[model samples]
Target: MHKEQEKVTDKNRFKSCMMKPDEEGNIYCPQGHAFTLEQRKESVKGRYPRTIQFYRNEHCEGCPLRSQCTRSKHGRTLQRTDKLAEMQIEIRENLMTETGQELMKQRSI
Candidate 1:
C-alpha cells in the first residue's frame, strides 16, 4: 500500500518561486521579463536599517500575463533590498533541505 503525501496549495508560491534576482539587483519574472530598479526609498533608523528598492517592468503594459502578474494600471512593480533578497533566497533554499524538513516536522508535532 502507498501512503499519500501532503500537497502544498499556497497561491503565493508562484510569486516566491518565479521571481529570480540577478547580481545587479534586477529581477526577472517567470516569462523572462526583466524588471529594472525604479527607485530607492530610505528606511527609518531602526534595528534593521536597509534601503528598499522598487522595480518596474515597462513591458507589462500590454503583456498577456499582466492580469495574472499584477493589477496595477501603470505596470508591474516589485520591491526588495539586495541584502534582504539574498537572505530570503538563502533561507528558502535552506528550508528545502532534508535537515530543514526534519526540523519543520518537529515543529508541527
Candidate 2:
C-alpha cells in the first residue's frame, strides 16, 4: 500500500478502538472519561451548509494513551458535522457491501 493509505488505515484502526458518541449525543472514552461539546460552528460554503460540533474531554490530560490518541497540548477533540457525518456513514455502509466492493475493484482497475 502507499504511504498515505497506510497512514489513513493506521489512524482508522486506532479510531475504531476509541470512543464514539451515542444516539443521545453523549461521548465517553473506553476509560469512562466524559467528553463535552466544546464548540459549534456553521460552514460558510459547501455543497450544502453544515453545522459542526467539536467535543473534547479534559480527562485526557495525563492518560497513558495520550500520545497514541492526540498530539494536542489541550486534549483530544472530536469534530462532527451534521450532514457530512450522516453522508459519510451512509457511504461507509455502502462501501461494506458486495456491490460497492465490485465497484471499487473496477475503479482500481
| Candidate whose lDDT is highest | 2
lDDT tens readout by residue for model 2, 1-64: 1222344443553363345568897887655778898999987785767788888879988898
* Lowest-sum lDDT 10-residue window in model 2: 1-10
Among residues 3 or more apart in sequence or in different chains, the pairs in candidate 2 whose N, CA or C atoms overlap within 3 Å are none
Candidate 1 to truth, TM: 0.67
Task: Identify the runs in model 1 with alpha carbons over 4 angstroms from their true place.
Answer: 1-17, 23-25, 89-101
lDDT of 1 by residue, 1-109 (tens): 0011223233442363446566775677655788887899988666877888888888887787777777889887877776876786687678789998898889889
- Candidate 2 is scored at a TM of 0.68
Q: Residue 77's C-alpha lDDT in candidate 1?
A: 80
TM-score of each: 0.67, 0.68
- Candidate closest to the true structure, highest TM-score: 2
Q: How many steric overlaps are in each model, in order? A: 0, 0
lDDT of each: 0.70, 0.73
- Cand. 1 Cα-lDDT: 0.70
